[model samples]
Target: MHLLVTGFEPFGNDQFNASGEAVRLVPDKADGHRITKAILPVSFQRSGEVLAALLQDHQPDALICVGEAGGRDEISLEVQGANVDDARIPDNDGAQPVKQSIVRGGEDYRPATLDPEIILKALHQAGHGAYLSEDAGRFVCNRIAYLAYGQKVPALFIHVPALRPEGQKATVGAETDNREAALKAQPRTSCTLPELAEALTVVLASLADQMK
Candidate 1:
């Protein structure tokens, strides 16, 4: 089975993007399967073109896209994408969408059609911390998820958070009261580039089986 995976470059203020790291790491751990990777810029025009080209080139049996979700603390298996576009911050290209639907004339892509029960069971059985999540967020995460759904392929997105660095506190202060000190308190989540790559390999391998 051919698998095509994608990750995005660091967007916004983040210094590191775990999703991109995961995409880079998985192929090394995977043995004896055809896999390809595409790293994307968080731009509206570029994403669709890149995605289309990737699908065309790889002709993959399955598509998996990974992106950073900064604050999320879990391995999220995205379920659906709202016919919405609301960005709190501009993407890496410094252009935010005011009223966009990922696809111009597309309908709400619901996740109810996917066989999550099978995928979820496989993921946990493979020993990775995984869960079925509803929101892929309104950012680039949902954009690609919906595109895959539109293409009549079994596609899904996984979201990882910005890994807290070593020796940091478990929690950071909100603001205005020594945020620098609070930033110092945040504990790292152990979700490193290499670690996420290993986890993604396990997840994708299980998914490829389910595809069969």
Candidate 2:
């Protein structure tokens, strides 16, 4: 099976995005399934456009969109995407949409075709912290999930917890800047980059088995 997996670029004041870094570590193949990976922009407008183009070009058997959820300690298997763009912060392009419909006349919500229960079980068996999430948030992550569900193939969004890079010191007391504050607020619960890659591989392998 061919799987198209996507991750977002670093946004805001952060130096790295967990999703992008983890996807970069993912192998080209998992359980005999071909994995095509792409790093998407954190733009509300262009992300969807790039994803649409990717879907058209690849036409893969499944699509998995991954994003970083800073405060979350576990890997989130999103079940639905809400058709709303309410960004608390500006995207990479400085676009901060407010309570706007992703597709003006679109449904209020779109359900992910991937089975969260199967994926969750696989993640647990692999010793990864994971859970089914109803909220993908109103950021670019949710936007990609919303657009992906509109596609022809099975699709879902996965949210990974923020990981602290090796050798980075914890901030003391008051934050020196917004970047420091953001970095300090992120939970350092997940394993290293290699482990994150392994977790994603487990997900892909499980999905491949399901297809068989």
Candidate 3:
């Protein structure tokens, strides 16, 4: 099976976005299925356009989009996307969408393809904490997660965190800028970039096995 994976460019409040690092490291670290990768601009306004282009360009058998869901501490497999858009924070373009569907009036939402039960089980067996997220959140993560299912291909959106680079804190900060605030407050995630890439490999390999 062919897998198209996406990770976002670092955006607001985050200096250590691991998604990009994870996706970039995939090809070198591990593989069973073909992994095509793309780095998404950190703008909600551009997400659909980029995703559409990717669908047209690669047309992979399965799509796994990874996004930084800052506050989450575990591997979260999103279950469903809310049709309505309500951004608690503005996107990279400074646009805040609220009370409107991701698609103004196109179609309803669909769930993820990687079995929540199966994938979560595997992650735990591999000694990585995991869970099923009720909300993908009303951000670009949700936007692409929603779009993936409508494409008639197996699709999933995995939310990762802003892991502290050296697994240590600055230990000296009086004021918290957006950067500092994100570092301490969101706590990114605990997993390393290399670990995430390995997990994606496991996911794709399992998916292919299930298909066979």
Best by lDDT: 2
Better of 1 and 2 by TM-score: 2
Order of candidate numbers by lDDT, starting with the best: 2, 3, 1
TM-score per candidate: 0.82, 0.90, 0.84
Candidate 1 global lDDT:
0.66
Model 3 bad stretches (over 4 Å): 28-31, 106-108, 167-185
Candidate 2 global lDDT: 0.82
The lDDT per prediction is 0.66, 0.82, 0.70
Q: Estimate the overall C-alpha local distance difference test score of candidate 3.
A: 0.70
Please give the distance, in angstroms, between residue 178's alpha carbon in candidate 2 and its true position after superposition.
20
- Tell me how far candidate 1 lies from the true structure as C-alpha RMSD in angstroms: 5.6
Worst ten-residue run, lDDT, model 3? 170-179
**After aligning candidate 1 to the native by TM-score, how far in Å is the CA of 105 from where it should be?**
3.6
After the best TM-score superposition of candidate 3, give how far the Cα of residue 146 lies from its true spot, in angstroms: 0.8
How are the candidates ranked when ordered by TM-score, highest leading?
2, 3, 1
- C-alpha displacement of 87 in model 2, angstroms? 0.6
